[model samples]
Target: MRPLPHHRTLRPDRRPELTLSQPLETLAFTPWPGIGNDIWETVAFPNEGYSYEVWTSVTRDPEATGGLRGGVTVRQGEAIIARLTCDPDTPSQSLDVIYDLKESIGQCWDFTSRSWQTSCG
Candidate 1:
């Protein structure tokens, strides 16, 4: 995979004050190639105050029998607030279009902690 861009800046005019109660549009979506019979996808939502990412995995591998496996990560500014795993029976969002905005601030996903954090670390 290519390295994620390190340089990004938020536009002054696009700064929005948002809350969980308000309707939000998808900000980014990333899909990973299937391994064996397992497929994975991740979707991001960016808000002014807090942002969130949901990752889902679907497996048809008979060796590892399972339903859907996924979780949600919530962030406030540069700090991670929560990481929650969904039940295997739960459903995830389905998206058709994929686009990324380079004008917005960027963060890194820390696999060790399973959360998003500032890239400097």
Candidate 2:
């Protein structure tokens, strides 16, 4: 685990946002299963030592991927860190999404990688 820098999540008494200390590129969502079709959800970037509180709302309509998606903004100071993108041609909501959630999002939903490894849980 990388040593996290000065960090603090501000649960504001009056605000509608969640904040993190670093850019989340590597993530593992808690229903570590399937996700992709356009659902806005959160991912944990452990390397960053913080959980990215993300979200997504359907835009226009819903398709196989639903529709255009509207979501959160991962920013640093005033610059945009990562913008939530809504891709309509994907299976965004499912029960098998395991990703890195960084600039390169990984989907382990199709049983591609060996999931279970050691004899420790």
Candidate 3:
């Protein structure tokens, strides 16, 4: 696997964000190579305070086999955060995700420059 770029700083123009802590909860993940598609789910902690995001992963690989690994995090609503792709030769996938929501700047920013997402990441 290649080394992906790390986003240490938050986006100024994106949107307001929540101070979600690390180690989010894992909900569910299903991957199928035999079916020619991999299913992935995780709650998204959007920049807009807090919200939910559920998405799917498509492998589009004919020789792929096994299941994808991912998780769901829940705070108030639900969302998917992390996901794993199937290995090229091997057949396995894992991920870090969540399922939930907590909206509003009060819920998001902690009403301070020092926020959960700010100091943690």
Please give the lDDT score for candidate 1: 0.57
Best by lDDT: 1
User: In model 2, where is the ten-residue run with the lowest total lDDT?
Assistant: 112-121
How far is 56's C-alpha from truth in model 2 (Å)?
Answer: 4.9
How do all models score by TM-score? 0.47, 0.25, 0.23
TM-score of 1: 0.47
The clash tally of candidate 3 reads 23
Instruction: Please give the distance, in angstroms, between residue 30's alpha carbon in candidate 1 and its true position after superposition.
Output: 0.6
lDDT of 1 by residue, 1-121 (tens): 2333343344688855444432223245554543456677677777768778778777667677677787767778877777777666566443322322311335444456654444635
Q: What is the lDDT of every predicted structure here?
A: 0.57, 0.40, 0.35
How far out, in Å, is residue 121 in model 1? 36
Residues 35-81, model 3: lDDT tens digits: 43554434344444444433345455667653343323333334333
> How well does candidate 1 score on lDDT at residue 83?
71
